[model samples]
Target: MATSGGASCSSSVLPCAFSRHYLAVCAQDGRLRVWNTDTQSLHREFVPSAHLSATCTCIAWGPCRASKEGPQRKKRKSEAGPAPDQQPDLLALGTAAGTVLIYSTVKGDLHCILDGGHNGGVNSVQWHPEQSLLYSGSDDTHIVEWDLQTGKTRCKWKADRSAVTSLCVSPDGKLLLSAGMTIKMWDLETKEVYRKFTGHSTTVTTLCFATSRPPDSDGLYFLSGAVHDRLLSVWQVRSDGKDKNSVVSFTLTDEPQYIDLQTADSKDKAVRLAVVCKDGQLHLFEHFLNGPCKKPLSPVCSVQVSSVGAGEGATPAPVTLLAAALCPDRQSLMLAYGNYLQPIVEKTQINTSERHVCLVRDVHTTLSLSVNAAVSKVKTPIVNEQKGKVLIPGVPGHQAPIRASSGESDKRKKGAGPTEMSIEERLEQVELSTLGRKGEDKGASASLQTDSFAVLLVQGLESKDSKILNKIFQTKKEALIRNTVARLPPPAVLPLVEELSRRLQGHPFSAILTVQWLKAVLTQHTSYLSSLPDLVSQLGVLYHMIESRVKLYQRLTRLHGKLYLLMTQVASSNSSHKVSDLDREAKLVYEEESSDDEEASGDEGRPEDDSDSWEEEEDNEEEMDVTENKENHTEDEEDANKDAEESKANGDSDMDPENESEEE
Candidate 1:
């Protein structure tokens, strides 16, 4: 499978998995594309015939070993195995036929196929980091473990009632994590569920362990993202009684399709977290792998993976992301996206289905400040108690700088020179002065003129923070909601509606607030929004979401009423022997009254029988008039028949005379 030139997946839109040295891609055409990470070139390609015509669904790469420098390390490296590149890095490809095809990249051939363990299509596959074992999850709701050497299944157990969509193994190879409708941690020794994590509201599709362990913490950290829930959660997999298993969670603006973790090149050993979302955007974060976890982790930066070439003000052509991986450097990202506009069969003989991977550079360096740098840049202030002053490092004090004269000597009059301050003192004074100047704007806004709550609400609506948006909707009154929506910018109107639609789904308790916001925005901008194509599309999506929610509520309500009726009947039947005829009649009367009350409540705003009476009267009068008309028509037809008969007799006599004359 090794090749010198660049290569891409031609007929594949399945998942891509990468190791330290290689990246494996499963394409729709039942072929596997493995690329060398260091060289950024195609290493090998495997054909679909090897998989027996089943389409690839997911892929996983075997762990590759890295080299060390010290003599002791060198001795261990020599004994560890072959060099990383020469080693037969295994690529496990899961297919829709309930089988796993393990291919060795160095050998460029199909190594083995693990089958018969699953009865349904395979959804995810993962390799043990240190052991020669492979695990796979399928639609059959079972997780199967396979021994790589024997090429046979070792054990299989039910992971979830729903299909397992993702799998992740711990670095120590003791715990296995499977995600479907929820996330479950399994004990490898017992082959039983240790605990379940229910952080995600919907299906969890992706899971990844942190690149390195956190300092002072024995628990293993991992990340899980739910595509349908649009949420990402960081969890610690340990039975530490003092700490919570859940470290932090984030609500994403878009559904996350993939997540990759890389160790940042810093002294603090921060982790570089990259998330590929459904909106064609890649969100990057520099988080600590050593310190205490914080709430509300925000991305340092977001990169548009799909709209790389789109010009300003132009709608980008739709592209489907097949796979995304972090480069070996961790500062670069490899994005594999499909161009739908390009024809599969071109006029030229060459196939344009494959293209070079889109490499996004400086993913980590693009942050404004590194985590270590930020910590180092901030210094504790020094207080001079004798002088009654607080002197902060890198901050300027109230003193001004002294300008030296060109002709004057260094030994000028000390009193005239204002007792020359040391260089450090002058630097501190300068820093303090700069910071002080920046704070003057607060005084300007301290006047009566200030930003209105409506403006603040608009800012919150435009913000990417879901917390702020949720809080505003949940706490603010209807008047403020209306005012804020009225002040929304033209470009932000569509997005506001879209956000409200998503909020309504995840936070049904906020549905009333969401509806208020939606009503105000659409009512205020009805004319302006109707002219935009994007608005039309967004409104269509919002309509569908609201319709689905309405249907679900209606179905639940009907089910609840049926259950209540059944319970009431059961209770009544259980006590029927103790009740007399009078009690039964009274119970029936109570039911009738309750039903009548419900009907009255349902028809509260409707007019009384007057409207129905008028409609009924009109219908009866029209029917009576129609019957009278039919009777008159029958009488007229009879009269016309008699007149016609008389006319026929006269005409017959006249004709007889005429015929006689003709005969004569």
Candidate 2:
């Protein structure tokens, strides 16, 4: 646990089980560590291999037995016996040497090693939902299914031409999902590909299923992100061919490192997806897959890890975020930065009038300190005075009392009250500040001062002024755009979408902002818009415009790339155009000499007795002609003689038989 000024725990794989009881992390130093939820301490640690060079590459915790229980099982088992009380937790750690080590948490012992299948480093490992089968993907571009009971490979197949980076099993245990160069779904029984999705433009490194399916959704919802791509896609796993279309694709400012899906709130209805980006920010998205939404998924907020524990205006040290997982309660996120594990909690501030106010700015202080505090409360080790031998805590009826300081109790009491204003209140304060600044700038311009962003936007749409609308949206934030759209009358939603779409045809630079506003309006009034039958034509027009704009942008991007390449070539040629006249003359002379040498060699290699060869060929041709004529003359003579003989024979036959036979 001691380290130098800077060191990173290997950023390989960090997996939190469905039950959220344990979090398993692998390090570059070939160490496998497990952290417990209850104790919040290092539950156990072990090296995956005895080889000093072995490095852990990926980790997977088996599905908890208790999570398999549901209403259907309860109804079926009403007449049957009760289930077992506990099952040992199984952990699978894949190493860089193409070896997989399985261990049991109950006994903390190595169970088996699966090393015969992969010839390259293992990239990912996933557990089957309802069986003892384990699926592992390796850099060899092969997926191997291992039977845990017998410690043997049950099946192995090539998943992709590229290394399979991530794997997930469907909840019903009927399908297996793999991602690498492309996303593919496979039939668990036959191992044939069910469907292929080419939505992501780069290599996909993460795949996760929603914690729970939203009732409004028709298929199993899941999330995928590529480490090299700046977009996160929400896809539906359907038995029907509707899986080709992704539910939504979210654009981000930075490439995503990890994605975790959980409930947005205590209701467990809305699906919340948290994407941890390489830029050290956690992007939170809500209500993306729960309802009938036709808009793009946008992040509600982004929390920066470095800013969480830093004081106001103090520069925070940059840290590389490797992975993130939501705790079971959805109140805290565990972030892995190199070798350090940090917990960021969403502190709930209780207001007497309002139920709760979330303050995200006060979350991180290192979970290691908490672990140390917990260890301290457990009492020191006991030693025998007679033999000076060591003893474990609470083994010899030594129950030490836990003492709490008064200041700690007081601090806990004060923590319950609200210490800051809510988001709405902050927005109102910002609005006031903005108004004050505007009033100071334009005291005599009453009309301009009276109109707010929403008013200006509504007026622009009513008058069909594209310039006004574009100017209004040029400098606004996403939240401000959404708020402005929400302030519009319900009947104006269609006009907003139409205006935004039309503007997109003219101004490609404002597409991002216009799309933001358009999505906000559509999302806010989805039910209202879907209820109207007469609006179908307008919606179609909007979709057509969006599709055309996308095509246009893609074409522009391609053209820009070509132009850039051409310019680069021109620039290089210009820079290297300073060839000296002497050098050019030498180059031409060398070329001329080489050409002359080639001509001389060509003449010398050719046969010098060309006339003699032609005479011999002519003589051979004449001899062949003479032989052909002689053969023809002989055949003609033979034919004439045969005809004469036939006539003589006929005459003889006639005299013999019919001088009697009328001389044949």
Candidate 3:
């Protein structure tokens, strides 16, 4: 059979049928369209008259001559080989107006119209392969068998209380299966229900017969798919007087609209089912009809046929798949929906010979390489022996032997070396090296020296090395000691602090650094440190040292301030005293000058007047010197006070009692 590639038709295509040469499609607008599969083009369109303005619900093609029976069939041959006087293959179209329209495929003309077969819309129709009969199920809960030759209903029966949604005939045309609210099997000759299957909780919408038998038995099987429950069931009719049934289910991401089965290959008998869902996705499943397993249907994959374009956070629009047809070649599928028909082709498989050849070649190459490597290894000793005979021109013949014996002796000596050192010895060596001394020179390294503070701290804590511990405290770098102590675990930090304190006996600088280190560790690691009671108890000493230092610094600061105030007051008092003395001297000098002026006027050329002037000048010079010295001293005192104020502004003092108390 030929398949179309990239061919699609405008949608609202309800039901579709495929023959060898032509594809017939019924649309919602009461129109029937035919397509030529070879040319991938529309062949004809048949639109019903305006008086019959009802949607076409389903369609099917008449059986070819090969499948025909009775005396009238002798006049017809194959579907593509009708005699000159024979009629063309017929097309049956079921409409929502409860009428069945028969058209001529070749002439593209309506030949017969079978009306009043269904009271409500006909939902499904199927033509008998070996008889001039057509069966239809409708929403009015009726199944009608129509005689195409006479254009009349042969019989009518009620299949269910609800709408008869789908119908299928057995391979031998003896049994008919109808699905509605339940599935029922009817004996065509007797025209009576033979059996009823009623497991579905909702309406059964689709049915199809399987062409294969079950495992370890020869039996006919059919599948039923239902709504609301999203269940597909398999029922068997055996020839050995036994029947079997099974149900398979899956998570319904969306409501199932239609299901179609296709055999993978006619020779292999492997079947796969395709389901079109309302969520714009077509899901595929593999059905193992002849397998020994209980469940026969398994999910394979799904493909998205449409996409919601309303952006995120918006509900996706529902898609209704009206019809689907799988090509007999099992390579292409046709899906019908709103205004579109899409064809999907199956993926091809790799060639078995080419794959096997490449695999074998890779294995052969790898094996050959491995064999060559092993052979080379097996011959390596002989090759080395041959090379050993050749010697350099500068070397003596006996020298090689001597060197070989020496190498052997060295290996033996190394293998028989002394036992390994203990953990304490190794730690001691590391500590001594960190303290800027050779490990062997412990006596000469009496003075505390810290080269690597971190190594010294870790080794000292681990080995309890008192010498290294003392050096860590003696190190002038406060930051180095603080960082090393902080790196230690909370449990070890307190003991290390106690040890450093013990070693810091009379060294105030070391003791202060140790206390600062302890405070930093406690403050930064309080969460981990608080869990250790010993560490928390040891914190008392650190707090005490900090408080004492704070109090001492505060007292020293207060004393300094008081001393400065006292010095300034004393300087001011002295200045005032000197000013008073100067005032008195000025008054006395003024009176003396007036008296001298009068005496000089009275005894103008006396020798005593010259001596008195000289004496007065010397006294005035001495008084001026004393006043200059006092002013200089007062300026010095003011400069000292300014310096003290600047130091206080720069936070040079260890404690400010006001800020310290607030912090506490």
Candidate that scores best on TM-score: 2
Give the TM-score of each candidate.
0.44, 0.45, 0.42
Poorly placed runs, candidate 2 (over 4 Å): 1-19, 50-52, 66-88, 211-218, 238-242, 263-268, 288-295, 307-313, 316-323, 327-338, 341-664
Better TM-score candidate (1, 2): 2
Instruction: Give the alpha carbon lDDT tens digit for every residue of 414-510 in model 1.
Output: 3343234456754554565567765443422221111234445556655567666766677446655665656455545655666776666554566
Candidate 2, TM-score vs. the true structure?
Answer: 0.45
TM-score of 3: 0.42
lDDT of 2 at 561: 100
- Model 2 residue 14 lDDT score: 42
- After superposition on all C-alphas, the RMSD of every candidate to the true structure, in Å, is 27.4, 29.7, 37.6
Off by over 4 Å in 3: 1-13, 49-53, 66-88, 212-218, 238-253, 263-268, 291-296, 306-324, 334-664
Per residue, candidate 3 scores C-alpha lDDT tens digits across 315-338 of 333333444555555655655443
Q: Point out the worst 10-residue segment of candidate 1 by lDDT.
A: 341-350
Give the CA lDDT, 0 to 100, for residue 68 in model 1.
Answer: 46
Q: Ranking under TM-score, best-scoring first?
A: 2, 1, 3
